[model samples]
Each structure stands twice: as C-alpha cells, then as structure tokens.
Target chain A: MEQLLQQLVNGITVGSVYALVALGYTMVYGILRLINFAHGEMFMLGSYFALTLIVSTRVGVLQLVPNVLLGLLLVFLFSMGLVSTVGVVVERVAYRPLRRSTRLAPIVSALGASLFIQNAVMLTYGTQYQVFPEGLLPTTVWRVFGVEVTLMRVIVLAISLGLMAALYAFVQKTPLGTAIRATALDHDAARLMGIDVDRIILTVFLIGPALGAAGGIMVGLYYRQINFTMGWTYGLKAFTAAIMGGIGNIPGAMVGGLLLGILETLGAGYISTGWKDAFAFVILIAILILRPTGLLGERVAEKT
Target chain B: MSRSRGIALFLLAIMIVGVGGCAQPKAEEKKPAAPAEPIKIGVQGPISGQWAFEGEGIARAVNLVAEQVNEKGGVLGRKIQVIQGDDKSDPKESALVAQKMVAEKVIAVVGSYASSLTEPASAIYDEAGIVHITPSSTATKLTTKGYKRFFRTCFLDDRQGLFAAEYFSKKGYKNLAVIHDNTTYAKGLAEWTKKYLEERGVKVVFFDAITPGEKDFTPTLTKVKAANPDAIYFTGYFPEGGLLCKQAKELKIQALFSGGNAVNNPEFVKIAGLDAAKGAIVTTEPLPGDLPYPEAKQFMEDYKKKYGDYPKSIWVILAADAMRLIVTAMEKTGSAEPAKIAEYLHTQVKDFPGISGPIIGFDEKGDRLGTIHKAYVVDDRGEFVPAP
Candidate 1:
C-alpha cells in the first residue's frame, strides 16, 4: 500500500509535465488538425533559454536575480515568452505555407523543424548536458506515511494546475475562446463570421509551444538536468499522452497525461521496470482498442 | 525459350563479375624485408559526434607515444607514421575507418572507442589481418568473436562486474539491489555482477533496469527501497547513475550507493552535486586523473606540454598504453610486419608496465590480465578519492 502510494506521487509529478506538453499537441491538433511534431523541441528550448538566462558566460546572471521566488517566476515567464516568439516565427515560416497543402506536408515540415531546432541547439550549446542551477526552488523533503514528498513536487503540480485552470477559463469563458473554437470547427464558416482564422491558428501555435516550454522549465527544475536530445523521448511520451486522452480534446489531454504517468509509474514499480514502456504501450493499445477515438473522444469543436 | 534467355542473362552476369575481379589488383601481404618507408600505425576513433573528445584524445595519446618511441630510436629502422581514421563514433562510419586503415596498410591500429563502434571496426581489421587494440571498450562479447588480430588493453565488462562483486562482499554487504539501464553494456554488467554475488551466497534482493532518458527514478528507487538491501549498485552510464544517487539521497535511503566504471566520471559528481555525491563508491580502471604509477606523472606533464591541456579522460592514456604495446612488439620482433608483431605480443609479452598502472598485459582472450580495478569514493571536495 505504501509502495503504491509512493509510485502514485511519482507518477502524478511526471504526468503533470507530460500533460503540459500534451496540451501543445492537442491544441494544435484541435485547431489545424495538424500534429505539431516540433512541440517537444520547444520544451527543450524552454530549458536551454532559462539556463542561458541564469548563467550567461559574459555575466553571471545569478547575481542579477533579486529574490528566489521572483527570480524563478521571472525566469519561467521570460523563457516561455521567448519560446512563444520562436514558435510564432516557426509557424509563419514553416507551417503557414503548408496550411493549404495535404495534411501530411505540415507534419513533415514540423518534423524537419524539430530536427533543425534540435541540431541548432546542439551546435550552439555543445552536447554536454547542463545542470539546473540550485537555490531557485526549495529542495526540502517531508515524509508522510512512508511517502517522501519534495517541496518542488508540490510547486510543479501547483504551477501546472494553475496554468491549466487559466487556459481552461480563457478557452471556455471568453469571446476570443469562442472565436478560436469556431475557427477550429469550420475555417470557411469562421472566416464568413469574421473570426480571422489565420490569426486564431497563429495564436494556437503561440499558446501551445509556450505551454510546452513551461513544462520544459518545470521538468528541468524538478529533474535538475537538461540535455539537447531530451525532446525525442519527452515528445514521444507527450504524443502518447495526447492520443490516449483523445487527441483534440483539451481536458482529455490533461487527464490522459496524469493517468498515463500514474499507470506507467505503477507499472514500473509493480510489474517490471525494464518493461515499463512496453507496459505503458500495451495499456494504451487496450484503451485505444476499447475506444477507437480515445478516452474522451477527439472533440475538435463542440457544437454550441 | 524464356528459360534459355534467363540462363543466358545469368551467364552474362557471372562473366561481368569475372571480368571485374580480373581487372582488380590482388590484395597484397607484406613480406619482411629491409625497411625503407615509415611504419604506418592507424588511429581509428570518433573525430566528431557526442564522444568526439574521446576520439581526439586517442589520437593525441597515440601520437605522443609515437613521438616518444621515434625520439628514442625508430622502430625496425623505420620512423613511426600515425594515420588517423575518423569513425565519427558511429558503427557505420567505423567500418569505413577500418577499411581506410587496411588500405593504408598500418602495422597496427588503436581505437573506435565505444563498444558498438569498436565491434564493427574490429571485424574489418581482423579480416584484413591488421591488429586492432581498443583502449577502453569493455563489452564482454567483443573478444569472444575468435578474431586472431583483435586485442584490448582494457578489461572486459565481466571483469568489472567481478571486481564490483568482490568489493561488495569485502565490504560486508550481503543483500544488494542491482539496477541497470537495459543498455547492452549495462545489462551485461548487471547480470554478471548478480551472478558473481549469487556465487558468494549474497542475496540479490532486487534486480531490474530503469528506462533510459528518464529524469525520475523515484518509483524504481522506491521499489528498491522497499527491498531494503545493504547497498544499491547501479550498472549504467553516469547520466542516470548521477540522478539515481541524487534521488536516493532525497528519499533518505539508508543503503550505500555504488557503481561500476561507467559511473567513475567527474561529470558524475557535477550532476549529483557534492552533498549527494559524497561517499558514493565507484570501481574503475585507473583514469589519467588517478594514475597509480610514477611514470604517469611525467606522461601527464609531457601531454600537457604538447597538447596544451590534460587528456579529456582516462581513455587517452589507455590508448597510449595500446600504442606502447604495439611499439614494444615491433621492437622485440625487429619487424614492422603486423603478423610478426601480433604473434610476438601474444606469446612473449608479460607484465608490461603502462602509464596507467604498474603492469599491463593481456590474457588468451586478448583481455588485459591482472586486477587493475580501483575503488574510489567521492570525497567532500568533489574529487574521487581512492578508497582504502
């Protein structure tokens, strides 16, 4: 029972990050019906961007940080802002031209963009994995009923939930949200209704990657290690999470990410750690077989 | 009529191959004669990619040895000429590097560092009857392929596993939890270590592998924590090993954390942080940073003087050890022919001293003989201090 509880804690922590990254893939799929394959790399960019800000060679950025909490908040917002800008440029240069082409073209473009970004980071930063600077967040751990709870775990969970809540509110409660949803439902109809479909899609590309970047920074802080090629694995898991949760459903991605994390962690803890990924995929296959559309169904646009 | 046409086409294809074979020059084998041109020694390793520093290290080390040998006196009345073959630390590229070395007719070749990269290159060199000595690749299966000319100055992974098992027992640790990353090298080491421990009647309470590229091992460590072993031995590369150490400390696991040679890296301490890394014991063959013999001090100074920096890691000096063996064999045989050099070293060489240690030599399996494994504990200063 203690073991189960411990793994649940571990799973939920990992799942939160997966959920954040999964949102990018889900939202992009929701609107454009295009899987943003480059979404994972944006998570990597977020970590690297934050790292550069914290420790630039020309000047020690740590000395510039005024206080721990404010410094971390600033780092998170600043890096996510930078990554979102990069995301917009990527959509403008790479995906925008292929928007009218066959669906396969944009996916291939996203993949190419992923490769280009991954390699560019490798060339710029070199291949050595960098450690996240310490003292940004409290590293204290407390034991409750044989389960270790680190302070950072609570903070990460809070940040992810906060972002998700804000995003959910923005999408469901605002006129801009309805306009975005309308554009997702039918591009021609939305254009006729003066929705500015191009701007809406651009907004999605911006929002999705920024969320992924935030996930990246969160993961880097919690894990305390970041590397250039981390995206391939993190991206794979996030894509799996998005699909499992019903690819185009926003809320489904959230539940799926957390669920997949818990399941895989329990699977590794109980069944066999070596076959953890195999176990996760096997469960995914079972879920998909039972529900072809996904857990919640791929809800592209809800009929108002 | 169609069958006859098919037969005619097949006959033509054979005739074309026969013509092509006839047009090519026959593969040449050197006969021992009066030396004229410089002796060609090939250096094969990653000149690019993630482990490029290791490849570059092998080159610098080999060249330094060659310079030392030539300064004393040219081998077999011929100056040693070093030819580099960049494998790019890739198995596909490793084959091309081997082919290039064979084409250059190098008397012996050193390197293609990682086990995956070296295995392919070793096959090519074996076929060409050119001696290839890897400096640091430790996969147990590499030497079992029955290649006459393939040798390694480094001990096999099983040897490392044995050294680790003995250490655990000597330290009075009976129950152990062993973790691996499921990589070929790590898994092999873990299995062998488990076997050795079981032979000593030590209970392996938990045995499993963690997924690579994972940032968290809390669940896996939690499971191991439940098992409540005397110590936890992680048989993986430093990246995951370092994280496991950090997380294990966070969980406040009472068991000591230990690992084999792959975790014996400065980067291990850097990743784990000084507080978490302290007291972690690592089994490693002597690194350039921890050279056991007096000659190593001079080697370091000379290397720094020539290269403008100390070697990238332990691999540089290990490559130098391989180069010195080849040179010694050539000097003893009084011949630059590869066959003679390989034969003399296999039969006659014993207790050869290397810069890395007091004595370095190979057994029948082309594995380095004698137990050279040193256990080092990460001290508070973040340096790997030799554990007494």
Candidate 2:
C-alpha cells in the first residue's frame, strides 16, 4: 500500500508537467485546428531560457534577487515571454502562409517547424545534456500517510494545478475565452460576428506556448537536466495525453495527461520497467481502437 | 569498297587502344614515389552529439599523436595525415562514417566510442579490407565475430564485470541491486556482473533496466528501494547514471551507489550535483589524470600543452595509443600496405608501450591484452580517486 501510494505521488508529479505541455497541444488544436508540433520545442527553449537566466547570468547579473521565490518567478516570466513570442512568430511564419491550403499543408509545416526549432537549438546549444543547477530550493521531504514527497514536487504540482485551474476558470467565465471557443467552432461565422479570428488564433498560440514553457521550467527544476531533443519525447507523450483526453477539449487534456502519467508510473512500478515506454503506446493504441473520439468527445471538430 | 574501309577503321582503332594500354603503366611509373605523399589515417567517432565530449577527447588524442609523430619525422617518408569522421555516437551515422573512411582510402581507422556503434562500423571497415581498431568499445562479440582485422584497446565486458563483482564482494556488499539502460554495453556489463555475483553466492535482490534519455527514474528507484539491497550497481552512461544517483539520493535509499566504466566522466559529477555524487563508487580503467606508466604521463603532459586540459576520459588515451599502435605497425613494416600491417600486428606487435598501460598486445582475436580496471570513488573535491 505504501509503495502504491509513493508510485501515485510519482505519477502525479510527472503528470502535471505533461498536463502543462498537453494544454499547449489542446489549445492549438482547439482554435486553429493545427497541431503545433513546434510547441514541444517552445517548452524546451523555455527551460533553456530559464537555465540561462538563472545559471548563466542570474537575471542581469544580479546575484541576489531579494528572495529565491521572486527570482524563480522572474525567470519563469522572462522565459515564458521569450518562448511565447517564438510561438507567435512560428504561427505567423509556418502556419499563416498555409492556412488557406489543404489541411495536410499545416501538418507538414508543423513537422518542419518542429525539426527546425529542434536543430536550431541543437546547433546553438550543442548536442549534450545541459545540467540544471541543483539546491536552488530546499530539500524538504514530507511523509504523508507513509508516502514521501519532496518540497520541489509539491511546489511544481501546486503551481501546475493552480495554472490549470486558472486556465479552466478563464475559459469558463471570460468573454475572451468565449471568443476563442466561437472562433474555434466556425472561423468565418466568428469573423462575421466581429471576433478578429486571426488575433484570437494568435492569442491561442501565445498562451499555449507560455504554458508549455512553464512546464519546461518545472521539468528543469525537477529533473536538473535539459537537452535539445528532450522536447520530442515529452511532446509526443503530451500529444498522447491530449489525444487520449480529446485533442480539442480543454479539461480533457488535463485529465488525459494526469491519467497517462499515473498509468505509466504504476505500470513501470508493478509491471516491467523495460516496457514502461511501451505501456504509454499500448494505452494509446487501445484508446484509438476503442474510443476514436477520445475520453472527452470533441465538440464538432469536423469542418463543413 | 565500304567493307575494306570498315576493316581499315577496325585496325586503326586496335593500334590506338594498344598504344593507350601500353602508355598507362608508363604514366603510373612517371609518378613513382611522388615526394611528400601523405599517409591518410581515418579517425571515426561521435564528434557532435550526446557523446561529443568523448568524441572531442578521441579526436584531439589522435591528432596530438599525429603531431608528435610528424615532429619527429615523416613515417616512411610521408607525413601522417589524420582524417576525422564524425559518427555522432549513432549506429546509423557510424556506418556512413565507415563508408566515408573507405572512400577516403585510409589504411587503418581508430574509432567509434560505443559498443553498439562500433559493431556496425567495424563490419563495414572489415568488409572493405581496412583494419578497424576501437579504443573504448568493450562488447566481447566484437572480437568473436571472426573479423581478421578488427581489434580494440579496451578490456571486455566480462573482465570488467568480474572485477566489479569481486570488488563489491571485497567491500562486503553481499546484497545488491543491478540496473542497466538496455544498451549493448550496459546490458552486457550488467549480465556479466550478475553472473559473476551469482557464482559467488551473492544475492541479487533487485534487477532491472531503465529506458535511456528519459529523465525520470523514480519509478525504478522506488522499486529497488523496496527490494532493500546493501548496494546498487548501475551499468549505463553518465547522463542517465547521474540522474539515477540524484534520484536515489532523494529517495533516501541508503545502499552504496556504484557504476560501471561508462559512468566515469566529469559530466556525471556535474549532472548528479556535489551532494549526490560524493562518495559514489565508479569502476573504470586508469584515468588519464592518475596513470602510473611513463607513456601515459608524457601523453598527459603533451595533451595539456596542446589543448590546455586533461583528456575527458581514459578512452581518449586509449584512442591515442590505438593511433600509436597502427603507426607502429606501419613504421615497423616500412610499408603502408594493409596486408603486411595486419600480418605484422597478428604475428608480432607484442610487449608494446601504450599510453593507458605499460604493456599492450593483440591476441589472435585482436583483443588488447594486459588491460586492467580499477575501482574509484568520487572524493570530496570531485576527483575520481582510487578507492583504498
């Protein structure tokens, strides 16, 4: 029972980051109906930016940021800002030109953008695992019901869950969120209703990458290692989460990400560790076979 | 009249062809022993990927050796030219590098860092009748494949594993957990260690392999903690090894953490952090910084003078020694012919001085003899000091 509880904690800790990246996939697919393959690189670049800010220069070479939490917040904001801008640029350059063409054009463009960003980072940063500085935060551990959890895990989970809640609330209540949904439903009708569909799509690209970047930062803090190609695996897994939960649905991304994370953890813990990666794809295959529309059925994704 | 004209044209064509054929050999004779003809030696390895540091170490080592040899005099009246082939430490890229080496017509190649990569590459070089020698690849079957010219400068997995198992027993760690990343090198080491430990009646409480390149290893570590071994032995490269060390420390698993030779890198310490890396045991050959041989010290001094830092690992020194071995065979034979060099290496080339060790030789299997592994522990200063 204790082992099971610990595995669950591990699952949730890993899942939240996937959820964060999955939000990018879900949002991009929701509005533009374009799977932003480059979104994962945005997450990777986010980590790189944060690593540079903290380790390389430490926020304009000021060693003391008054408090570590404030310093971390500053790094997060800066990296997310940079990556979100990159995301918007990617949309304008890669997707905007081909929006009028066949749907396959954007998909191919997304893949090209993905490879371009990955190789760009590789060439710039060099192909090696960049180690994140450890001990930025304290190593406090808590034993709740005989399951040990660290301070970093708690912080990451709290921040990611908090971000997901804020996003869910905004999508439920805000007029901007409704505009996004309307534009996603019917771009022409939404434009006729004065929604500025292009701006809405830009907003989607911006916010999605911002969340993915935050996830990247969290992963760096937790794992203490970042590389250029890491985004691909994380992105593929997060894409699986988005697909499992329904690619175009918001809450579905969250649920699917968490569920996959837990399933992978428990599977590795109880079953064979060698098949850990195989477990994710096995579930994906089963989901595709059983429920092709995903856990939360997408709302009229078909284009007329 | 047309038939007579056709017969005359055929006769004229035969006379011109005969003259051209006769002139070809005289043209080759005209360039006999062209002054300053360079000896091209192919150096293949991962020069730009996850293992780029290792590749750079190898490349610099071979070049330093070449520069030193050239400074003395040209080998057989020709400058020793080093041609580099970057494999990116990938198997697919390795085959391409081998093809490049073949196309460049290098007499011999000293290359490829990992076992899986070296396997594919050696096959290509062997097929093309080129002598392929690896400095770091330790998989046993590399020599067992019956390739006449394939050789390695490192000890095999079983030998290294046997030494590790014996070392653990000497330290009184009877109960152990063995882990690997399922790569050819790591898995082979793990299997050998497990076999040797079982032979000595040591209980392997836990055994598993983790997927490489993925960061999170807590799931596997959690399971190992449940098994509650006296020690944990990780057989994998540094990137994942560092993470395992860090995560295991975080989990508060008190088993003595140890690793195989692939984990003997400064990057391992950097990635694992000071707190997690201190006192960790690593089984490896004599590192460049702490060698007892005269050739090794000279090479280290030369390396520092040339590059301003010590080579990344002992494998770098071995790579340099591989270059020396190939050059030695070429120099003693006084010929650049591959067949003579291969025959000389097979029959003679024993009791040689290597940078990694005092004595180096190749057996019938082309495996380097007299190489030994030492167990080291990371000291408080992050140095891989020999364990007492």
lDDT of 2 by residue, A187-214 (tens): 8999999999988998898899999999
Q: What's the lDDT for residue B94 in model 1?
A: 77
User: What tens-digit string does per-residue lDDT give for candidate 1 at B76-181?
Assistant: 7778999998988777777667766766766689997899999977866776677889998887789899887788877777877898899899889989999999
Off by over 4 Å in 2: A56-64, A298-301, B1-142, B145-150, B294-355, B358-362
How many pairs of residues in model 1 come into backbone collision?
Answer: 0
Best by lDDT: 2
Q: How well is candidate 1 docked (DockQ)?
A: 0.63
Per-residue lDDT tens digits of candidate 2, residues B295-332?
88888889999999878688898899889988988889
Q: Encode model 1's per-residue lDDT on A165-234: one tens digit a residue.
A: 9999999999988888887678889999988888898889889988999999888888778899998899
DockQ of each candidate's interface versus the true one? 0.63, 0.60
lDDT measured at residue A209 in model 1 versus the true structure, 0 to 100: 86
Cα displacement (Å) at residue B42, model 2: 10
Question: Cα lDDT for residue A152, model 1?
Answer: 85
Model 2 alpha-carbon miss at residue B230, Å:
2.0
